[model samples]
Target: MVRNKLILAAAMLSSAALAAPAAAQNEQFIPILSYRTGAYAVNGVPYANGVADYYSLINERDGGINGVKLLVEECETGYATDKGVECYERLKGKGPTGAAFINPLSTGITFALTEKTTTDKIPIITMGYGRADSKNGAVFAYNFPLLGTYWSAADIAIQHIAKEVGGFDKLKGKKISLLYHDSPYGKEPIPMLQVLAKKYGFEFTPIPVTHPGVEQKSQWLAIRQNRPDYVLVWGWGVMNGTAVKEAAAVAYPRDKMIGVWWSGAEPDVTPAGDQAVGYKSLMLQHGAGKFLVHADIEKYVYARDKGASEPGKVGEVLYNRGMVNAMLGVEAIRKAQEKFGKKPLTGEQVRWGLENLNLSDARIKELGFEGMLKPIRISCSDHEGARDGRVQQWDGKGWKVISDWYTANQSETEPLVEEVSGKYAAEKNVKPRDCSKES
Candidate 1:
């Protein structure tokens, strides 16, 4: 009996010794704050799928970034700020590396988490949405707008409009109306738009629509009466479809309507049917369709029955956007591993990687994103990275690139960023970081 007991104890000890190292292996934890439920689900579902699937592809194909597995956990925010905050607080401390960074996805949630993430030393990537001034990284060190900001989007849209109308001088005496959501997200472009309007002598009108934007009959009626030369839409979720439908109802020429990136997804146009054809929106790097990355995702992720979204919806606009967002996150991790060792890294270390990101044409082509995205290089002073985008129009079937990539003139937008961000720093008693000393 004593010999039998000794043998069992020896076997158990051996098993534990073998399991210890495996359990101690490092993992990159990414917390996804998604809104897969509620009014925004139609738009949210595809995005969440793209974000999740890209991370899955990396893990399944390359065994994650540099052999450290990626661990992603989703917390549904239902598109509400309070729920988003709750989700962030719950998942910020999970996994081996502890929430490398967060893509708030929603401008409202981005605003709410800005202070918290700054204090926590975690980065918030608001790619294409959030406080425009957050592009001034000196004051907002923890916030990375990545591809573009609303200010940049607005600037690019205006450039497209100028091209359409002959030149910047042709914009003189023209009237442009902004039909926006009556929230911080919607109001973000107003300051920039105002600056441009004053510069080019275009009459700018600000129209507001309430949240979830289903009822915009009055707003559309105003547009009909005013007959503005161009209408810029800044809406999301059901608001997008409804805005397009209402514009059609008023017989507004679809070609004359331009929406921000968020307002141009599949969910935003399918309901508008043929009326949405020729409806243009800004494309922050990519529009939609299968790129080089999709082939690998199909083989490594969906083929294994591990796709986060339906196979058919893999390359839609928002889904592609999510994939790019996830790609940036993973690349930042890989860059950090180059400096901090090939192991899980803290949020601070990841921040350094993001600041130093240099996705050149060669690197992008190597990553299979060749024509899908413009090359970007982030610096301590420039968190918005590449302030360039293209115009895409929905063609009844899918989105098609309508204009050449237009780079937002930083000369026109930087002063505003500094003025607004400097004001914020003073109000909050925050000191802007000296990029000269960062190294």
Candidate 2:
């Protein structure tokens, strides 16, 4: 009887091993590192929902990308860096394609995964947040900052403020305070802000808030006492709403305060109620409201009750951002298939596709995201294909676009990118890649 049982177990193990390769051959695995149950859950939930829905829409509508289905597995990180790294390790080698790319939603996680991805040969896409200097693709080959970076956001914020105050020349004697979350994510825009401060002759002050950012009485008190000309908020999750409430408490004009992209969502402002009215923020590309693609999602995924999020949240800002992120990932896979065949691709092949991504205006329109994203073309040297963003302001009811699309001043940004990334390369003893060698 013992020998018979052993033989049966061995037969089952052999059958499972045979089935694994067949299953892997038909799907592309994309690992989602998400934070849906933490201090940042208010913002993280919407983004995660959007991402999952987009993947669902692709499978339901297009029958997957070129018939190769996307198999996404979510690992909750709770916005913790250590947990995020663990999630990456656990899911990086799953399925056939093996993690097309990873979007480390938190800057802290992105920083932790930067070196790991380089060694593992997996691409890390930090759509709007990450190490700003990672834009220099020569030094950071496997990382893509995508649509925009913190440096560009800071530069655009300064530009908007300068325009409001007349000009860069008028920035002289002006005081701008940065109320940030006191983390690597919060400190990301400091170097660029300091550079702009020196150039425009404005006083720059950085005030930090502790994690979770519920207690900011002292920070707001400082802002009240200083009465800076404007306040730039670099916060996430609950921190955003709390800062707005404190600003209201101190009677600071909401119109004079601006937040980064992460701080401008419905959850960020809705908590402050009427106090958040007139608050402004930088838009990574698209703002809130449904677009063409959203209609499709509503028809194919939400209406059919196959959506990942609440049907009502089909087109919120973070939701739209998630759709855009998934769209980029899918397009990269499509591009990879152009060369590597329409089958499950390795992470290295996906990297090649990401590097060569060229989404024209017509292509974007065809994909039902015409007004949602600007035409982006990535190359070996320029991983951040688009640098332009618009400004939006929250009225009593909702957000409204206030400025035309503005491009980052690459003259100022490129030099800084080179300086910082070059220093990083030297410290890590990494030899920068030569783009010319690539076909």
Compared with the true structure, all predictions reach lDDT values of: 0.89, 0.89
| Model 1, CA-based lDDT | 0.89
In TM-score terms, candidate 2 sits at 0.95
The digit string of per-residue lDDT tens for model 1 on 382-415 reads 9999988999999999899989989998988999
Candidate 1, residue 43: lDDT: 87
| RMSD in angstroms between candidate 2 and the native structure over all alpha carbons | 6.5
Error of 1 at 8 (Å): 39
Per-residue lDDT tens digits of candidate 2, residues 1-439?
2243234234423533455667658888888787778798888878987887888789889988999988777778999999999999988987776788999798999999999998888999999999999998888999999999899999999999999999889999999999998999999999999999999999999999999999999999999999999999999999999999999999999999999999898998998999999999999999999878988999998788667677777689998998899899999989999999999888888989999999999999999998878999998888898998999999978899999998999988888999999999999999999988974
lDDT of 2 at 125: 93
